[model samples]
Target: MPDKTEKDQTQVPFGELLRNFVIELIVYGILIAIYFYVALRFLANPLAALFGNNLAAYAVISLGLIVVQAVFLEFVTSLLFDYLGLHRLSSRPGKH
Candidate 1:
């Protein structure tokens, strides 16, 4: 058996990495913006009513939406990265 070396692995160019980072930022921002837009326009009043003017409930709901937005962005960006080959497959040897 032969030992694999890190030097054998492929690397992306710095420019491509920077470009990908920018793209990721824009995508995440868009997702979060959509979340806030929908939550504020549609959910805020109804939730405020349901909780009877409790500010804490709105805070909790806002935090939950943030978490959900982050998770959704992560899932979507991961899929896009995989499809676009912006990142390497984790199943590759020595990736861990």
Candidate 2:
């Protein structure tokens, strides 16, 4: 027989899970919207020119921009989640 510690036995309520999920979704949506707006507003002309001038450079730049966006969004989301006192669904017990 296996011993069940309190941590192992505990379960998150569905309501709390749903709430956290909703909050995360909303935050990500807003962040993505803002990111797109800023990217398009500032980089559109430059990227368009690059694309016209050099295909390889444009492709590399586009890929780099995507990576940057993903990292930035994830970083911001973590900060926001900490600030909002929300626990990540994927986080495991005893792990920061």
Which candidate has the highest lDDT of all?
2
| Model 1 lowest lDDT segment of ten | 87-96
Q: What tens-digit string does per-residue lDDT give for candidate 1 at 3-77?
A: 865553666676876787778778768876887798667976797695787878777987898898679868888
The reply for model 2, stretches above 4 Å from the true place, is 1-10, 80-88, 91-96
Q: Which candidate achieves the best TM-score against the true structure?
A: 2
lDDT of each: 0.72, 0.75
Tell me which residue pairs clash in candidate 1: none
lDDT of 2 by residue, 2-89 (tens): 6643353346677887787688788879977987798678989998999999999999999999898779877888886765546544
TM-score of each predicted structure versus truth = 0.55, 0.66
Clash number for model 2? 0
RMSD of 1: 5.4
Q: What lDDT score goes with residue 58 in model 1?
A: 75
